[model samples]
Target: MSKRALISVSDKTGIVEFAGELVKLGWEIISTGGTKATLDTAEIPNVSVDDVTGFPEMMDGRVKTLHPLVHGALLGRRDLATHMEAMREHDIQPIDLVIVNLYPFKETLLAGGSYEEMIEKIDIGGPSMLRSAAKNHAFVTVLTDPTDYAQVLSELTENGETLFETRQQLAAKVFRLTASYDALIADYLGKEIHVTDPERTTLTYDVNQRLRYGENEHQAAVFYQTALPTSYSIAQSKQLNGKALSFNNIRDADAAIKIARDFTDAPTVVALKHMNPCGIGTAETIEQAWDYAFEADPVSIFGGIIVLNREVDAATAEKMHKIFLEIIIAPSYSDEALEILTMKKKNLRLLQLDFSQAEVSKKEMEYTGVLGGLLVQNQDVIVETPAEWTVATKTQPTATQFEALKFAWKAVKFVKSNGILVSNEHQTLGVGPGQTNRVGSVKLALEAAFDKPSALTENAVLASDAFFPFADNIDEIAKSGVKAIVQPGGSVRDQEVIDACDKYGIAMVFTGVRHFRH
Candidate 1:
């Protein structure tokens, strides 16, 4: 009997040419339903799978390729006498190759398909055949990706058979494809029924890019993104100009975007370094916002990532061009602004994201990897309102001080744990993030606030990520000119801290919510 190859695919990319090449190589082709019709229309010689199985496709073509004949042809060991005898007894012709790509489940889910539509798009026979061929890779060749078609054909034409190593690699790819396919189905079904934590969890992501290094020059890294594009995400942003983003660039850009997204009420600019916000400013105009952010910390803004909630105008671009920024991300850019920024800076990455779709989806989750386990949690996208807070001090914040406190509260949420932020009404005066102790962070923030040529600490508000364990934090704040403060207010010594605030005539608010970014 002639060597037979099975071809079933939903993604018809390069399928006709591949099948025609196989036909020219004197190989028999077995196909089902749409694949057979496609090959027949292309005038490619092929045999229907129904003929091989001697059974008509039933139940809307779902039961076509799930027969023993297909499995025996794929799984039979050609080198074993017993296997060969069993195949002969059952009149099963060995299938030398399997080319199958699963149904469009991911695409359908992204397209907002209904539950019934998603269920119908899940491929059953395709995975079964691919797994059968992959498990018996010693005797069968399997292909799921279309990019492998040319190489597989070249090897078949030259060597008349795929190399053992090639077969093993292709088999591995098949298993990965099937596993990802099933994971998508499982995740979708789980979400449909509101199953937050299933007994078994599976996740999948597609490779976005391979970076030169991770956080350091000695480590390797690759970027992976979800199958569907996420709105207001750094991974979803389009690079308009400059060199490809590195690992550090991506991390800082993500931090900057997240911080910028929190201030949608006004034109906002966030300057980030080492995954922390160095300076954040909001104003009536984007240019003014840029000026406030740059003035917040001119020294730290150098070589940092900048994310803006508004379009980049020519004025803002000119000011941003003066600094050596690693990246500048905005919703859009004027023609002259893009020209001015791209002319002198060829290595500075320019990213454009759509801020219109900045709303957080309910299905979004965050994942972090540890030494031997993974931590999964809902994304911290919540923005608390001032109505849910309580005054904890005798002094009350004035109108301007209240707005400044609100800004500081939102800005501090993006900072690392033990975070302290000193700010006026519209700009961040200083930021101290990731300190070991609360008092240490307070001193760092106060020092940065007062170190400037024109100190920005007069009537500034302070925001801490978590509660102060001791009154020493308030004492440190008292040394500075900060007048108002915001914190979670959950420590056992909360009264002592409040008393320290009252001693200094500082107005404090308890949000009853903690924003720890560890």
Candidate 2:
């Protein structure tokens, strides 16, 4: 006549103590193979599934809880005479409370698991049992997640019966946990490496925060995720020691992180202001990269966010401390490095890095705000190559200038369309980025270029994300006196642009690849 409880969990985080509490509360515990073994080791008495259902587990413990006895107990309403009669006729004891957490399917896929391991990790009976209990909430109480263990126990001790509101909240948690879990399985099966279903996006991420406000401070904002595992996305970031990142902070941090990755081997540094690079440099050492990047435009770098592809050492931190930088992102920091950085400014946000794997196992769906609803697309391209290009002008660029032009081209891809990047040998001099017209952008790019008259020869090379729509780009760019250019030449007047480049004695290469990151 005592109340019975079912407990099974893949993440046995707080199980022993939880079982012990149930023992003190006089609840008869029913469990599967591993859960029962764990409870017995903790000296917690439990009834195994075989003993309770009188049926042995089959299919490597998969068929244990799918039996009629388990569902009958969870679904039966003690207040209903017909349910009680059926329970008595079937000799099934009703289960009062169910605590079940599914297998770590999310973690399994994240840890480079094989197909066999993933198939085994997909939970079956656990979610079914939890959902059954949740639906019959008027008669039964269900719990998922070890985080809820202490709170549930406290409520039971505070009052014998759990509050209706608490039951409702726990039911909601059950659904959300299952939904996120299901989303992971679906997205993994259908997405990731390549889309098995292009128009088959079934996952919808729920917001973790309804932001204080959105871009321009007038629109409403919320953030969500597809629950992908181990991707270097904002969803998995743990802000251990800083103020809440504003909408702008997260956006800029993402941009800076990708930019830093462009120069993988070199100690690259990118200083971002308003989601665009204010200064960028690559050097032999992170310390040197930080120094050159800051020197690229010391005035513009003030209050900008700096990202590094390499680790930040004490020397680099020491140099960064002298400025009013808002944030510093890097792969990692040594103890000495953290000590030095913390001393300069206690609140300067220092973010750890995410070294990219070849293919991320997770893919985020697209969503854009419109007048009536949301417009959606996948995240923009991050990979681009300049392998197939043509030399379109008379005087070709030197190999050194070619390399710099390629670097400049890659940097331009992350900027808005019609972006113009001004770079010398080692660093960006000025960036006239995210403009409406290509000519206007080129002019703005040359604004900070007058500083180094020595590098502004008629031989300096230029790179555009895409081709010049008209020969005017070639004419204006020639005025800056840069004589070489690299672009994806597919415009209608491409030959005219080529003629203009030749007339100005400029060398141009068509990469045959276009990267527009709007």
Candidate 3:
């Protein structure tokens, strides 16, 4: 008896060649709808699925492949005597191979598809046949990706049959694809129908690129893109020039871009190292912002990533080329700027992205993979303003001091836990991040400011990502000549912290909001 292979796909990249090879190997082909027409057009011998079932397709082609003949052929166990007897009694031949791929639900959602259009795009029969075949992997070979065609054909040519291990691996891929496809559809419908929690939670990521290594050299890593579409994310960035991004490079780039987005009112610059902001500055002109930001930590900005909210000009590019940098990202670049920067170093990664539409999508749930399971929660996107703040100290901040306080509040969010940020009116003076204790972070930041006399520590204001535990942090800030502070004020010793601020004659404001990044 000649073996049979079911051929059905929405993506027809390599189907013709794949089917041709199978035909040359003496395998009977069964196809449905557009797939049948395609095989006929290519002059390949095939049996229409309608011919196998002896029934015309109904429900506008939706009912073509859902009949018992299709599923039974795929689900029948070749090793079971009873299953063989049942198949023989019904005159049904086993489907030895199943080639299937689902419809593009994700693509449709991104294309502004109508509700009705998207409803039609959700594939029913494709996933059904894939699951049936994958469930019976001991006897059937399944394929979902076009790239697997060559390997499958090669294996068949060598052994005259697909290997059991190959069948098992292909079966696993089918379930993965179908699960993600169903998850995408449910997420879309949940939004349309206003369902808070679907029956199951699903997140799918596609491998964007393979990195040389992870945070360390011995570990291997790869970058995967989430299903949601956003042009402002690092995945969508266009690399104008430079070496491929590594794990650390991508992490730093993401931190830099987020900080740059915080200061969209004017031209801003953020220089980051090891996932922490070393220098941040906002000014009327990008040139002045870069100068002030670089001056904030001239020693640490070496080989760091720099991001700006505006385009890069020739003068800025010339100054940037003087220093060793890992990456530079902006909205766009002047032709003269590109010519100068590209001419300076071939390994400098230059990226162009637009943050204008990043806020269009609502904040989605965030997840972290643990050793046993995943920890999921809503993203912390709560925004507050000075109008929603309280002046904890008797002395209110001056207008200039208030503006600098607001600037520091935004910049501090990007810093790691136990983080402290110091900034004068124009630029950041020092930043201490990832400390074990709040007082330790305060001391580090103060010492960083006084390291360079030009930092003007006496006139700077401090912002804390979280509330201070004791008055010790206040003592450290006052010793550095910082006269103002901003922090979330819900603490067991809030009065102690407030009394210390009053004792030092420092003005303080309680934002009633905390940002803790771990």
Candidate 4:
């Protein structure tokens, strides 16, 4: 008996050559509509589905290959006597090879397609055929991706049949691809149905790349990307230079981008080390922002990653060239700037990301992996306005001090808890992160501020990640010459903290919302 191969696809990338290769192997080809046309145009011998199934496609080509003849051929059990008897009785020839891919539902939705058009693109017959072939992998070979075509052909040419292990692997890939396709459709329709909290929601991602190592050299990790792009996520960023990105580089660069995204009103620069922003600065130009950020903590930013909200020009690039940085991330860079930076340092990683094309992050979910499971939560992207704040001290903050307080507020939330941020106007003076106690963080911040006197410790403002449990942190802040402070006023010692602030002639405000980043 001659072997039979069924071919159907929405993506016709390698279908012609793939089917032609089957023809060269003496396997009879059975293809549907467009695939049959392609094989015909390529002068490949083929049998049309209508000829095999004895049924014409109907419902605008939606009913093709969905009949018992097509499925029975793919799902027949070659070893079972009863199944072989039924196949002979029904004159159903077993299909040895199946190649199929689904429709463009994801692409159609992303292209701003109409509801009817998107609905029409939801493939039924294609997935059904794939599932049938996958279910009978013990007696069949399945191919879903074009990248596997050459491998499958090589195996067939060498052995006269695909290996059992290769068939099982290809069958597994079919289910994975179909599962993702179904998930995209379900997610899209779930929104229209107003199913805010469906009992089960499906999301699928494909492996983007395998990294060198995880956070440490001992662990292994791989990056995955969503099938449907809903935002300009960092996973979609383009890396223009340097070696392959490690796990640590991705984490630190993500932290820098998150901070830079918050300052949409002006050009912002954030220098990060070990997932903490060491220095942050906002100015009218990228050059000034870089200058202020470098001045904020010249020592801490030695090997840090720098992220900018604006385009990097030649002037900013020249200044950056003088320093050794692990990475630089920005929306864009001028031709001259790119030349100077890449020419100056060969190993510096350059990443270009445009946040404007992204969806609002508040709608997305964040997941943290735990033992045997994951802890899922929403992102903390809420921005508190001045109208929501209350003054907590006897003396009100001056206009300049209040502006500095707000700047510090935004900066402190990104720090780890027990976190403290000290700033003077648009630039951060010092930052204290990952302390066990608030007073310890205060001491760390003040010491850092004192070390960089040019950051202006005299009237610097302090922002705490949470409520101060005692007035000791307040005393520590005053000792550093910080004249203004802002914290969530939920602690039992709020009045005591306020009294201590008044004793030091420091102004204070309560934002009402505590930013506790653990």
Best candidate, lDDT-wise?
1
Clashing pairs in 3: none
Tens digits of per-residue lDDT, candidate 1, 306-364, equal: 99999999999999998799999999999999999998789989999988877763347
- The digit string of per-residue lDDT tens for model 3 on 353-401 reads 8778656422656678899788887655666778889999987788878
lDDT of 4 by residue, 355-438 (tens): 786337557777677897766677778857886799988889999898999899999989999999999888998899999988
> Which candidate order results from sorting by TM-score in descending order?
1, 4, 3, 2
| Residue 138 error, candidate 3, Å | 2.7
How much is 494 displaced in model 4, in angstroms? Answer: 2.1
Off by over 4 Å in 1: 361-363, 453-455
How close is every model to the real structure, measured as TM-score?
0.98, 0.86, 0.95, 0.96
Misplaced by over 4 Å in model 4 are 358-362
RMSD in order of candidates? 1.3, 3.6, 1.9, 1.7
Higher-ranked by TM-score: 2 or 3? 3
What 10-residue stretch in candidate 1 is worst by lDDT? Answer: 450-459
Q: lDDT value for candidate 3? A: 0.89
lDDT: worst 10-residue window of model 4: 357-366
Model 4: lDDT of residue 369: 76
Q: Where does candidate 3 stray beyond 4 Å?
A: 196-200, 454-458
